[model samples]
Target: MPRVPKIIPISDLRQDASGVIKRVSASREPLFITQRGRAAAVMVSMKEYEQTQHELEILRLLARGERDIEASVGFNLEAVLADADALLAEQQ
Candidate 1:
């Protein structure tokens, strides 16, 4: 079963902006904001927003790696793994 999205009108948001923000932050769920009975924007907690940005950056890096592979440009896999191991050991 699909879960229903949390939707709210702009006026409701305006009337209880603080409460709405609290609910979104506590629930860690997105709140859909509608204007003129149409979709306008989506609100998410700061942590969620930051996490999404981080994930997107990782995806971008993976895509870049793929492109590099296609162009036959990359470091040796074993050397890279060894470097990664050394970096991890330094933190420990």
Candidate 2:
């Protein structure tokens, strides 16, 4: 599991937004921002943000694998049949 960074409330951010931004910008980790005691947003350095986005994309791709199988997107019947024939020939 990925590590969760420190959480900051929006009210505290209003007091010193620059400092908070600077701190989060300097640190590669993400800062969770909460609204009404619920997680509302996240602040992270540009590199970290991009990395998070890439990870999410990979997760999305993996999640779609099952759907791809259901859709029979890349099923090669001829290739499968040839391989099965070869296997049976070898067994014989």
Candidate 3:
């Protein structure tokens, strides 16, 4: 079963901003903020945000590699692997 998302009104958030931040951080899930019954923003823990950014960066790198291949741009596999290893190590 899919989990229902946590949603809250802007007014509620404004009333207890600190509590809302703590809830979102502890839950490690996106907290949907609504204004006037419409989606206004999403809040997430800093750790979650950082992880997402890292994953997106990896995807972007892979996509760029694919584009380079399609364009017939050549790279040394060993050198690329070494660079990738260094990048992954840095993340750890």
lDDT of each: 0.98, 0.88, 0.96
Per-residue lDDT over 1-92 for candidate 3, one digit per residue giving the tens place of the 0 to 100 score:
99999999999999999999999999999999999999999999999999999999999999998999999998889999999999999999
Give the lDDT of residue 33 in candidate 3: 96
Greater-lDDT candidate between 1 and 3 = 1
In model 2, what lDDT does residue 29 have? 66
lDDT for model 2, please: 0.88
Check candidate 1 and list the clashing pairs.
none
Q: Model 3, stretches more than 4 Å misplaced?
A: 78-92
Arrange candidates by TM-score, highest first: which order?
1, 3, 2
For candidate 1, lDDT tens digit of each residue in 20-87? 99999999999999999999999999999999999999999999999999999999999999999999
Candidate 1: deviation at residue 80, Å? 4.9
**Candidate 1 has what TM-score?**
0.83
User: For every model in order, what is the number of clashing pairs?
Assistant: 0, 0, 0
Winner on TM-score between 2 and 3 is 3
